[model samples]
Target: MNYTLHQLQVFLKVTETKSITKAAEQLYLTQPAVSIQLRNFQDQFDIPLTEVVGRQLYVTEFGMEIARAAQNILNEVQAINYKTMAYKGKLSGKLSITSVSTGKYVIPFLLADFLKQHTEVELVLDVTNKNRVVRSLENNEVDFALVSLFPDLSVQSIPLMENQLVLVANRDFPMPKKPLTLEAIQALPLIYREAGSGSRFVMERFLNQLDSKGTKKMELTGNEAVKQAIMAGLGCSIMPVIGIKNELQNGDVQIIPAEGLPQSSQWNMIWMKSKNLSPVAEAYKNYLLENKSTIIQNHFGWTEQL
Candidate 1:
């Protein structure tokens, strides 16, 4: 209770590494300094933090609980630091972002443009599947995430762009005369993104509502893999209209009309409501708002900026 955030941080580092010396090395602190801080923190708690068994430092159950609390405090303190830096008009702070893999095709370019505009900001990006992005956001592991149709999380999402999900097949495939129903689409072999992905989640929900037997005939992890499979005529796949502009233009793939499908999904910019935005985050958000159409046009080579 009487411990400073610095001391709690040292305690967490020591607890995680299980060695005062190793924690000091990782934190760029002297071993004796780390040891003293841990001792002081333990004194405040009036409990033994670590026990030496076979030359390995082990955190007691009580100590581990304290460590968990310490971690939350440390995270809040870091968030405060980020906000203070922003308030000072000094846009130099770490901005961590996690996004779905399909975003890999677009987000990197958007981030690059933001960095070009604000060279002072440090950006770290975790490009992953949709579920991991949502998990990272919920756990406070990242500052913000760009994802598609996720559940209503404890955070807020600002939708940047609304995009249609199009059913794509190789140009050689037979074209249906009318807008296809879920049953008709389900009759074709389907290539799908993994289950937890935002695209897959939206597609599944839409299909489940329309046809009880809807299922993916094949699964692929990345957008590139799905594109390759669809191009090879292995199966039909659904993706954002934005994602396959090049393929569609080149006549490599064709869109299959599907009725009763959701009209569009948003490319959302999301952050925890309780967490304050850093200056760098604000800058990036502003950049996205202003240049979203340009980025979309550049990515898709659209004649008219949308």
Candidate 2:
């Protein structure tokens, strides 16, 4: 009745994919290795865990039940490792964050140092649209959220860095011979991010504030797609400078030097007011609060000049 954790892992993987070959590929082991582990794991149990018929692999009902138990064992093992690291006076736990799509450019830089310092901590950064990010935060599904659009939600935030959405177009697009004005920029066809995106929300706010009547071209989800659309001469868009730095530098796009832009907002690290923070989460928040300015100055000093 002796089966190793490796055996259990192989067993679970086989059950998941219903193929020893697939389990081997996913586990980065040879097929023979996986086969051996599976055989060793199954030797202790009399009931069959899997079956193969007509050249197809299948997990039996009992195999599915054992897979659940194996998953629980893996989970407990992970928890024990975190607890042991904490026992050694190291901050060890999960630091989960849900960030708006554009926040992808910023969140990783913010986390890089903290993760390096606390090697025992596990990080999960989920990048999605503003609605999902806010939903994850409000549902207490994550320790923190990175977002720009602060709707009417009961949350507290720590402002991290300046986020500016600027009007940009393909380098080959037509530009006014005169000064770049709101009217001039708005006269061009425009591309937009999807409705519930933080970028779109801010873009709408700026346009509404200026009473713009620009022709709307099309809407795309995610910053990269919008950037690509603009580069392909599809249309112009107001995009976060952070997400377009590479494109701007490569001459793929050009920023319109319109007054009152780049429309500015602070990238905020937000959390529900009543949620209790774990040690890892608290340490990360404090690290940002204390070192965010330094990190920005070091990695993003160029952003200040922009």
Candidate 3:
């Protein structure tokens, strides 16, 4: 009934990633080592923990229960370690952050200065869709999440920057010289993000407000893919201005002058209020609140008007 913390960590990683090989890579351990540890962990219990079917690992019900307990234990251990480091007035620990895909445009810039100042801190950034980011936060897997849409009232949200969504088309696409109406814009072939994306949610809400019944012409998974689709003349899309800065500067895409366009949203850094944050995470949060606007303006040349 005894299992080392390292074995539990390996088990948790395997369950989280659903791949022994991936867990090995992430833990920087050999695949055989991970497999051996997983086997040892399972040997401590009578019931089967996981099953492999068609090359995919699936955690059983008992395995899920154990995984949850393992995560709690791991979290508490980390909390204790961070608390100890705090008493020493030292800032040296890992900070795991998850953010929406569009956040890729901003979080790195926000982190650059912080990283330079705290050379001992390790930062792990995961860029995904809004839904996945929220799930990560809810699971306490990440210390903070950056998103445009606040999922619920339970988390502490710090508004960091303004995110503006704008209609963009390939520079070669025929665009009206004057601003188009909402209905006109709706008629154009539109490339859109997947349903779970915050950008898609905003765009859909905007269209719904206009009472527009038209459906998007194409659906892409990522911002980069949507940008590529637009540049390929596949379809136009409504995207966050942050993600299109490079393309706009290069004249690969142009913002369409549409009535009621440039929908404004807020970029919020969110964290579970009930959870205790490591010193590094707390410092990064404060840093974002204090310096995000200036850093963003300097890095992206965005004005308050945006």
Candidate 4:
């Protein structure tokens, strides 16, 4: 009962990261300071909030319950702050967003104009695989998430632009003069994104539809790694066209012509439908919807696709 919001924040950060050191770094406090606040918080509750077993921290069931309540309190406080700012016609707050790895190629450009206009706003961008991004959105850990695949239908999504997945290989790799069948392409050694990647999900679905079990050459972590592996002649991969534009133009990699290739999917901006949007987030959502088409066309020269 004697705990302060700062203590709760420390506790929450510790629980989220499972490391006192990491929580301290994130909060810009000393490790001892974080430890002190956590100790005080647990003392107030007179309960063991966390336990470390074999060097890994685990939150107790009671700790999880309190953490949830703490998050709710923090959300309410943030909402109140946003409401006050809205009354003053000010748009200034931290905007937390997570995106699938390939979204790194597009989201920065999409947000450039908005960031310029809202000079006082700060951004926290987390680029990760689709699975983690979706999990974060489900937990209400971020305000927005950009993804190519829609895994959960419960969350509201706004379609932003189209993403094309193209088969790419090292420039020196042998290429057929004519388009190859899906089965032929599947027979080639394929560099693939790791599990939980949106690209991997799409690629798996495409391969399943062809009734072909593709040969996996290697499983890499991110798009950049996959591109590097392919360019080194490790194998071919299906990559987002947007992420490969430079390599495609520079002759470092070439798109392979194939039947039933170039899988098409849309990039979507998503958020939890049950959560109340802060004024800043609502403004950003409107901004993205209003300017999406023009932005994509102007930046990527995909006007015809629209």
TM-scores for every candidate against the unseen true structure: 0.69, 0.74, 0.85, 0.86
Candidates 1 and 3 compared: the better one by lDDT is 3
Backbone clash total for model 4 is 0
Highest TM-score among the candidates is held by which one?
4
Of the pair 1 and 2, which is ahead by TM-score?
2
- Candidate 1 lDDT at 93 equals 72
Top lDDT: which candidate number? 3
- Cα lDDT tens digits, model 2, 1-306, are 787888889998898788888999989999999999888888888999888899998888988898989989986887788788888999898899998888888888999989999998888889987878877876778999887868577888998888888888899976667657777667778898999887787788777656656679998988999999999999999999988888878999988777678888888898988989887888998999999889888877877776
**lDDT of candidate 4 vs native?**
0.86
Clashes in model 3: which pairs?
A: none
Model 2 bad stretches (over 4 Å):
1-80, 210-212
Candidate 2: count the clashes: 0
Better of 2 and 4 by TM-score: 4
> lDDT scores for all predictions?
0.79, 0.85, 0.87, 0.86
Candidate 3 wrongly placed segments (more than 4 Å): 1-5, 40-89, 303-306
Cα lDDT tens digits, model 1, 1-306, are: 778888988989988899998999989999999989988888876678888899899999998998999888876877777677768775667789988887776678778867776666778899987767877887777888887775568777667666567788999988888889878877778888887877787677666765365556799888888888999989987777677778888999988877864356777878988877766677777877788777766665562332
Residue 218 displacement (Å), model 1? 1.6
Candidate 3: Cα lDDT at 12? 98
Worst 10 residues of 2 by lDDT: 205-214
lDDT tens digits, residue span 1-306, model 4: 777989889999998999999999999999999989998899887678999999988999999999999989997887777677767787977788999999999999889999999876778999987778978988878999998888764788889888888888999987898987888888989988999888888888887776558999999998999988888989998888888878877899998888887888999998888878866788899999899988988888852342
